[model samples]
Target: MELQKGAFYLIEDIDPEKIFTAEDFSDEQRMIESMVADFTQNEIIPNLEEIDHQKEGLSRSLLAKAGELGLLSADVPEEYEGGEMGKISSAIITENISAGGSFSVSFSAHTGIGSLPIVLFGTEEQKKRYLPDLATGRKIAAYALTEPMAGSDALAAKTKAVLTEDGKYYVLNGEKIFITNASFADVFVVYAKIDGEKFTAFIVDRDTPGFSIGPEEKKLGIKGSSTCSLIFEDAKVPVENLLGEIGKGHVIAFNILNIGRYKLGLGSVGLSKSAISYATKYALERQQFGIPIAKFGMIQNKLAQMAAKTYASESLIYRLVGNIEEALHGKVDGREIGAAIEEYAVECSISKVHCSESLAYVTDEAVQIYGGYGYTQEFPAERMYRDARINRIFEGTNEVNRLIIPATLLRLGMKGQLPLLQAAQDLAGQLISLQVKTSSGGEVPLEVEFDMLNRAKKLFLLIGGTAAQKYMKKLAKEQEIIEIMANMCIEIYAMESALLRAKKALAKDAASAETKIELAMAYIYDAFPKLENWAKQAIAYMFESNEEVRTNLSIAKRLSKYQPINIIDIRQKIAKKVLEAGKYVV
Candidate 1:
């Protein structure tokens, strides 16, 4: 299985000369994005209050309307009465529709985890039977994996499925909790242990006997989306309804989860942008101290921080989407597609962690900027704050996703995919020489920032590679070290992504991309200190010997070196632009 080529597989693999930005959206993608925006404003936003009230069937009804516009089938294959639109198309749809508040959860779940399992792992017969209705959203779909006993440890599910003596059906008896879209889904992709041992996936219809949904859960946010428990009281399902291979349900569960994590990140980006727009508008309209609050430095700070992080998150999300779309292109088989997406599992986890946290921060700042009105239900920030909380908790908690990042990194290194060992050895040699090359005059704009990013990548390789060598297999047990690596990776990826996007803009027309350059500079300058601190902490904790610590710290300080810029001023500049536009300026 050859891993598909992409923009970059590792931090060191980033090409300072190469650029990939979201600005290059295709005409079709833009059209789809515009259509989704229109639908979100017309069909979803006005009814947000009613949907959040859980007006019976309101969420599903809006999904049906979206489906009527073929919004739900963007990623489904054309052969299955689906659109077969590219991944970015679907990502844009998800991004635009995310402004609809809680309905975004329902829509994303239905289109992503709900239907994609069948799209990627289902049998031909299964696709023929289910994809049509799911594609059209005539019958909503739900994924049931989390159980009362199993949330993060999904395979620890107590759900049991046994084949009957008639050689026909599997009697499934278990309960799945906190299931999205459970209230009105027509089909469910459920996970259970076969004969109380092998984990397997099954496609069960909502009308299956003994299949019942528990009452809707009262939630902190996204109240408009359906959440309930699914009870399988000896639910009899046909043998052919099984999805993927028996005893291999983890494949489906994890691959679908990878897709879910990144899509959730994209949703976070959209939500953060919405929050910034709301906050900026509020600041402009709500005057304080005989002037608009937008004039205040503190308010400007909050707005700038929100836009900066949103800019970084958006850059990275679309970059990953482009990578996945390229990898999955021309692949017809489900397993092949799954393999393609799994190659970038590390990036997927990074997107999930970084973007979700960005959204959380953005929403918190939005609430802060809105002041008293922000806390009240009268303003959108109140709901934004609530809805954003769940991103950090779900799609694998940020903690869990953080652990996955370093684990996947090590796996890729061991597989010779990332060349970490070689990079570390080379950096160690260079450290002895103390001869790091700095950018010269006549370099491209922001070349110094790019050089600093490259050094940061080397810093990561130095620390992470050394940790891997020292801890060996025991690194898995060192959660703290793993988290440090994850944070370092997150910062590096976000900074580089913004840089690449900004450079792409410069490549197009440097004169008009000043904001893009500012976004990159502000993000990189803000991100460097965090990466430096994380590197120092990891080195301090992992290196017990004093000489080793001193040497590594010296090398780290050298590699992490950068000429400081006034991020506050750049941020103020960014804030002024955001305020002028009344949204995320980037």
Candidate 2:
């Protein structure tokens, strides 16, 4: 695949900062997260083998235990016997519980995509009848949206839902594949075609005639979570079972997937951190040639990169979560939730792509760090590596997510956010000031750096502007590349934004002088070289054949005045803090 200059440039300028301090979490949120983590460590970890090996179904006893702790109720409303913790807190709980192997998939599905539809779109009677039981894990909920013919093209569902002549019920006939909780679900939110033209969602009970599950398919990972196909052979569903307005199933499906994407990212972040910790611990203890493997330069480089990427993922996910919270501060009704969530499609998609891909990189390196043992089932890295692979594929594949990010941004651009253009201007100004301060060095031509940065900025603006104009109306069709670019830009912007915030915080805090100084130095030391390289590469690729642009790349490379510090040492300091905190802190 050809590199998109705009996307590559965005990836190049990532800066490190303490944007996500632990202070952002509420005491209750932290407490719940701790409770979930403890539950996973104490209750679930010891029984992973049983859950993984049990063929009859999920361990009923374990599900009951989780329900007792209220782990299954975070997303449901309090009136329905749920915690009503909102997405951020629910995400924290999901992420922490993910440490319990395949059971996390079961837990997240029960709380998120499976039950969110009823809470958001079901009628009052529907909520009363189902939420209480679903929340308490007395019943399991499943969402059936993807069919054999409609995986990525989900709206093209062929399943039929025909209304009875007297309008008493709908006769549903469809098969949904790869449902997470299908084998054990008591209630299912199923979507099917209506009158050959419209799609609608229905809540079908497991006891309904013709509602049956296919044999569980052996899967690549998440073995403990039941995976099967749901078959509805002329299943009779009451009119009251319709999730929302007829033909509005698309709204529920898409919006729920958006939330699912964010939750998936959050879970991936936790797993990535776990992978890093396992690798680092192994590196510190395992010796080669009479010394610890971590003492080797290449091994240290891998560790540093994993830590840096994990930090970046941590910073981005929490920031996105905060944005969502701010967007939905006073809104409580389900009608308002859709619009509120639609506001964050871009950020949610970016977070999904960033965290998932980061975990892929981190986990792969973790296995490498463990050498041969990492590839064995005896070690956790092997399982983590396998489980981590699904994040990028499911929950709207990363390829699909790439499209959503940029397309949403472009659509927003037409509405005047125009993030790429604004960000480019800000970056150009920063480059100009950096140039002016270093003009006296004469080591590299300042004019060349200015020319390269400006050209690269212009190219980014041009591509973004073109996409916005062309796909302003058909946002979904062109969402893939648009998402890829948007994700890249958000990461770059976030890194720079965090650096600025950290710089200001350091300047104001007198008591944190020593710590602040190290953070500030680390940001500059790590960010500048990468930013310069990114600008140069972006410019070179955009105008490679143009002599004027091609000739300026050498000048951009030589402009850096600061010497390269040992990034390994800097990252070790960061990793130590992360380890001590038992999570990414700052």
Candidate 3:
């Protein structure tokens, strides 16, 4: 699973090693997945409207019940009375709960963003004080970093904190907007500039003096989750509550979000899976011209497209999890864990942007499949459509994440963390001559896709090198090229991930891997051309001469050349499987 250390991202060696996938889950993990799915479907789905209305404080009660079941403690250390399950199990919990709608949003905030700060950055005293209660659902937790003056620019927050004269407390004064779980959370991980200079984090209690939550906000989605503003006027926080270190709040704030972004991808995939289920069931039952709509080729095409995209998204997410877990090597300490996860921050952002966009596409098609009912609130497709829109905005906007992908890689190159520039230079000489690893997977499937994927990497390097050379120090400011290169990087990761999973399925001797193979082929068929077009755009932007543009496009055309797979036939196979199961089978 050595997927080219850090931001180099499988650019060089084609190591189709034994990567992790959903099929690789242990028996315990499968049971946990089953248990979570049961809880979400039986308890949360049936009571969704009541929960959506926040009736009788039902959302809070349900969260507490989840805590009692130890679902909320997957990432917490065992010393604090937590389940201490690893990343795979936590991903299962995150993925399975997504169909519960806004309750999943609330659940994710509490378990992931809210409580994880303490688990990952808090000191010994802080963990002992907060983890037990949070782990047991005896208390709720929230994270507040977004301020009115700052949205994406989080480090520029206007919130201020001044040390008390007695040195016992820090007085906080400012406002934080869009605070999730604000209405019921007992603890908050808040960030403020110390003495209006040093940015820092503090664990502020709900009972702190002058600490108040504003009225609930009206939002388009995730309505069941409480979103509000935090007003702090001379609010007193104990000095012991200081998280991480002074002037290093970015370490905690930014690093925690790395985990959040990956989890967002996992949740998006889960919700996409749900959308498939909803659409498949509807297509099967709904009749048109006295026949099931599932019989229509158009509807089947949509279902197949949805399943293939989701397969790619799911593949990339679990592949990322395997890499991160291997990097951590089972460490539970605070800084060590944060730093390890931080190492793969680029991959996480890729997961965030790609999967969220995939969810948006999946949900939209789901609504279209439902015809008139999808627009009305009477069907789940409408709610799913509304809910899916927010993921592209969460964990940082897709635009921001896209910029981060290339920018981070460039930074790593400058710092000599990864030999990105060197690889680009070396690849330039070998672009056309670079041979695909036919013997790589050892008599396995997707050999054609394997070649396309290898060529895709070279194509990315050629354009990336051109962009870097042309823009030089000003590459980050070249937002358009930056985003184009980022999308290329994302597609490269996605193509490899799906290919690896298909190989893994056959490697594991699955009873049936036809659909997995078809999914990989179908996705690669669609993604490779998009990669070439993106490369052509970047080339045209970088070079003004038409000859240079033509030359580059010619190179890309050769690199992207492949016998197009029969996507319609493959999609029909995928749709047959999905419609028969009435869910995302592969």
Candidate 4:
């Protein structure tokens, strides 16, 4: 059951039987999920306003309660007074807790970037000292990485940590802006350059003299989460507190970021589901022209799209989690887990980009469904809209993640891990012969959709492979083309995940799984034209010679073309399901 390190597999290597879908949850998982749901409704929702206002001691109190309930320890080792639950269990906890509005951001940062650096990089002594308190929520955690000067170019941080002549302590001096949980965190995973050149990570306690928290920053949303600047003026951190190897902090930083990215995706899905529920309930209760707004076709469109997007997000997030868990199976060492995560860097970026964008889309539609009231501070839709905006920006901006997707794909291609070049050559041969290869999934439903998905993958290869050959080591400068390739990959992954889940559902109950099928179909149909448009843009950028443009355009048209579905009817059916359940059904 353990995955071998240094082994990479292509999509063809994946077994359909082993692919985990949302419905694969065990009763035990469901119980934990229900516990989180109850806690969110009873504990978090009631205290929303207080949390939003940054009430003194309130977030910590709630976090302590979460710790008491063992909510904060899912990923920690059992020996560290933790749950030692697998990735799936931890992911479910994160997804359920995301319904808590701004509080979820605080929770995510604390568990993810805040504590994971230690969990995945700390020495035995460090873990023994910090993991127990963090697992029990006796001490709050925060991540300090973003500096005033170092935003996207994280390595350009001006913060410096110099070891004393005796080498017993590192005298750190720097300021980190936008440190989540800054106002209340008792411990920080601080990143700085050692001796002014080597990037490193240090565990700095809040009570350390000369370490101070600046005033909280006002924000667009997620106001309940503490955000402040961390000022370190010659703060002395014990040399033993350095995490991982010196000059290898990027190992801890990047791997922990991958964890944050995927978890952010899951949390986005949770928020999307919550937004759909809020919008649907509002639509059902609010009347327009003496009838519930849910009866209106226009309103139905938004509701259906929101539900479909949420379904897609949920499917992909869970599927990705399953992969990560399988990859890390039987591996408990911090470095091993980090390497396993780093192996799926491309998939992590895809999930982060797709799910966050999906949430943004759903929340926007949720606001639109609420009409004028949605624009006001009094409505939940407005808050959801504002809160959802940050997902696309944080954990790495979607733009940065988009770039990472294609870059990672190309890197994998160069390493012979993805068969990208071979696939592209095959695709080109087929295109020249006018022979189209369709997906073959025996006895599977939605064969046409799956076939289209196959073609989409080919289109991604055709465009991406051509771009790579044409640019030839200079493609990094072609940001737009990279973005297009990334978009194709994102859509391909989303469509695949949704299709696989729907196929699984159909196998279990063909008639009852209608909604799942519709959602999958809707996502594919919606993505087709967008993918084509992206292709057109990429093609335009790739070639200036008329013959080259014409030839590629023809190939793009053929690969991107698909028969459109009666999406309006599907939406009506889907919206009916949402309206009936008063939430996202899938």
Candidate 5:
């Protein structure tokens, strides 16, 4: 197999000119972002109480309103009366609309997992029948994959379907729980097993006979989005409604998740920006002692960290989206697009894990900055705190995604798709020669960080190669070590992305990139130590020999040692910028 051509394996030679960053978004994308931001602030935020209360028809009405603006159609094709815009446009909509909170959940449910199955795996007839209405939000869509017994183990679905005597329909029987958009969804992309063996996907209409929606589940977060179970008792779905091929349901299910994960990460970035703004404004107004609380070092620390992580998350999201778009360029066919998205599954998982965790941190700190007010329902910080918690559990739990990062990388390496073993062998030779170059000594802006990224990758390769050699085929069972290495990989990606984005901005105009440069530096100065510790842990775990472990730890230390930038100055400067701007401007 050829090398996996993505961020994970394609780490050696990335051109800043070619790498996409948020600063590189097209004019049309900026327009779309502004429009969605207006809608979110003007329409959605003001109606939060009503939406959260599950007001009758309010959520659906808002979704229809978005449809009129073509917000619901970004990922659809022109022939189907859809927007036909690129994925970046679609991502912008998802990112900015997140300020709407729960309503964003409803909107994404309708446009993403709910409708993407048909958009990507549906037959031509299926696409024609569903895409037009779905694109316009005339028919809301939902995905039914989580059954009562199969949350993580989705393929072990108890939902059974069998063709009827005439073979025109398949009778289904099962329950799907925790479904988004369930209360108002007009169509559903459901998964069921045939003959208790062959798992398959089906497109079921809301009014299908014997199909019933369960009572709405009272949720902890995203309260405005509908969450209910679906009961399919002898429900008859047309044979033509089947999505993709029988026994290939996992293909559609996982591929849809690849896109979902990245979009979710982008949504996290949007919300983090909002949280920073909310917290910063509150701190400026709230008094402490003789001056505003914003003057406090602790508050400044939180603000700086939030903005830094958000910057990193935003950078990685765009980078990942750019890769998907490049792979998907000119591919109009649904299956082809699905295949393209599946190619970057590892990067998608990284985005999901890193961004979601970043949002969790930002929201938690926002509440901290808000102090007592943050805990109250009167402020958005409390709500944001609640809302951000579900993302880790959503898409796939961070644990599952963490395992996926390494598992997929190693799997590809073993299958010859990624030259992991070969690269590890080369690095091993370097370890013997102690030829690991730690510092670049480059004096240019962010060149230190560029050097830091290279060292981080070398550390990952070092720890990973040792682990693979020690465990061979059984590395998967060492969950602790694998997760530690996964965190290493995640940090490497975050550092590289932030570095690239800031560099791209500097290349355009160095004077204008101070905040971006500081953000990248702040994040790297803060994150590299964590990476170093993880590398140390992996080195310690995989090696029983003290001398070998000592050797690897020394290499890790050399790789980690760099001229530390003014971290205090960096964070304080970032915090002051956000405080002055009242949001994450850079």
Candidate 6:
């Protein structure tokens, strides 16, 4: 469906059956979350200002403390010094600790993208030598993939590894930029060009003769997290240090990035919820117009919008995580895990973009809610605003991510891999063909709307398919853009699925329902118009010519059907729940 510019979608129509609830969280996972949350509040929050001002390495003591609590080992196998929990558990911990600010970046990098290479690509010996120590936080791990010229074109790294005449070791020479955890890293998973044509990864130690770290960088946000350049001057890495076979670095990089995307989304959710909570409480306490600002319709509208965004993010994350977990059951080995992760690259990319964008929107509105105080350092919203900016830029710029999503969807469609969408569409068609009566005894005809939706879906498929075909032929230059379009399509598809799910739920329990159902109805009512607008925009951007002002104006006029709800009020309601829970409960 198409969505209009500046129009808001309601989520009240979402099915409780499909919605992720607290029951989905395992007791052990919940316990871990509690520990991380308490630890962050007790340890990190008080010291955040000191750490940021000092611009020092995170105190080694804190790392050791996290290790002791098993926070550093959630994703590692039980055979090592790890808790052996799955990605969902790791996500929960990451989200909770994000409230700790910059420290969360450091902690997540240490446990996730940093350590994953060893677990996925390392030899048994490598795992034995490093996983235990790394898991226990006795040794810090770093991943070096981005080079001066190879930011998003990760495969074009200039770092070279050459074999010695005796074949005893490979000599490495290269530099890596924006390497997180570089300052105190004990080991690095380095990717380098091999034989001038292939990229390979290696494990390098910090104390190696030719290994050195550049000075720490001053960043826009996440200051407490160390970011620096790594220089490898003729560093000798043993052949055994190779992470995987030659030319296979792409596998390791892509898989780890996929997982990273999910983790990043989880972190965004936490920060967004925190921002909403802070703004809501401030609104209720800060009086304006002779009452709490939240009592005003405008403020309530913002609150509602915030809550709706948060709900969408939360729902998508849990759904994707559950799907990944189900797909990965009994598949614990590296190759199996990598394959599973690669299969969901599209979903991961979409989640990353959606959650990051959602956080950005929520934080912006939050700052607005706080009025003058939100811009001042005296409040957390300002800091959150700064911190939230990076989520869209890093891991892969949202622009690049967008291309990945639509391109991946196109590929999946061509291969008939996305059966769910087809099934959903078929069901929608059946429902549309069969007329149904509303609870008010009114006959509702959805056939026309369904036809429009079907046409929109076809348009998306065609545009996405054409883009993929053109881009893949010139992949070296257009891969990033391809990813952006791919992501956009995936998001469109997901929103459509959510709307469908919401409709089915309402239809099933038209007579007997509770408050959740009411909320679902409100959400669907609000969401449908916006979804339609988005679809129209997507179609216009793809098929409409530059001179097609008539088409553009028509789409714009279609968007005028719904008045803008008071987002401030909606955000306040969301904020109250967030404040009451002290975090994002959903």
In candidate 4, list every pair of residues with a backbone clash: none
Model 4 lDDT at residue 410: 78
Off by over 4 Å in 1: 1-11, 15-19, 434-443
Candidate 3 lDDT by residue in tens digits, 1-586? 5544666655654455557788788999999999999999888999888777777678889998898899989988899989988889999999999999999988999999899999988999999999999998889899999988789888889999999999999999999999889999999999999988899999999999999999999888887788999999999999999999999898888888999999999999999999999999999999999999999999999999899899999999998898887888767676787788889999999999989999999999999999999999889999999889999988789999998998888888888888777878987678657554434333556777788888888888888888888888898889999999999999999988898888777766656667888888888888888987888788888889899989889888878777765789999998999999999988
Output the lDDT of residue 7, model 6. 7
lDDT of 5 by residue, 447-480 (tens): 6677678777878888888888889789989999
Candidate 3 accuracy as lDDT: 0.89
Estimate candidate 6's alpha-carbon lDDT, on a 0 to 1 scale.
0.70
Q: After superposition, how far is residue 424 of candidate 6 from its true place, in Å?
A: 13
Alpha-carbon local distance difference test for all models: 0.88, 0.70, 0.89, 0.86, 0.88, 0.70
Candidate 5 has its poorest 10 consecutive residues by lDDT at: 1-10
Which residue pairs in candidate 2 collide?
402-483, 402-484, 403-479, 403-480, 404-479, 405-483, 406-482, 406-483
What is the C-alpha local distance difference test score of candidate 4? 0.86
Instruction: Report the CA-based lDDT of candidate 1 relative to the real structure.
Output: 0.88
How many steric clashes between backbone atoms does each model show? 0, 8, 0, 0, 0, 58
lDDT-wise, the better of 1 and 3 is: 3
What is candidate 6's CA lDDT for residue 242? 89
* TM-score of each model, paired residue for residue: 0.97, 0.83, 0.97, 0.96, 0.97, 0.83
Report model 2's TM-score to 2 decimal places.
0.83
Better of 2 and 3 by lDDT: 3
Which pairs of residues have clashing backbones in candidate 1? none
Tens digits of per-residue lDDT for model 1, 1-586: 2233531444444553443457878788888988998999998899999999999978888888888899999988888889988888999998998999999999999999999999999999999999999999899999999988789889899999999999799999999999999999999999999999999999999999999999999999999999999999999999999999999999999989999999999999999999999999999999987999999999998888888889999998988887888788799787898789888888898999999999999999999998989899999999999999999978788999998888887777788777777777777677666545445564678888877888888888887888899998899999999888888888888888898888878777887688989988888888987777888898889888999889888888888887777788998999999999998876
Clashes of 5: 0
Task: For residues 1-586, write the lDDT of model 4, one tens digit per residue.
Answer: 3342221223343434566877888999999999999999999999988989989998889999999999999989989999887899899999999999889999999988999898888999999999999999999899999998788678888899999999899999999999999999999999999989999999999988889999988999999999999999999999999999999888888898889999999999999999999999999999988999989999999988888887888887888888889988888687788878988888788889899999999989888988999999898888888899999888789999988887787787898866777777777677765544344343556887876877777788788889888896898888988888888888888888888889878878888778899998887788878988888888887789989999989988888777666899999999999899998996
Models, CA RMSD each: 2.0, 6.2, 2.0, 2.2, 2.0, 6.1
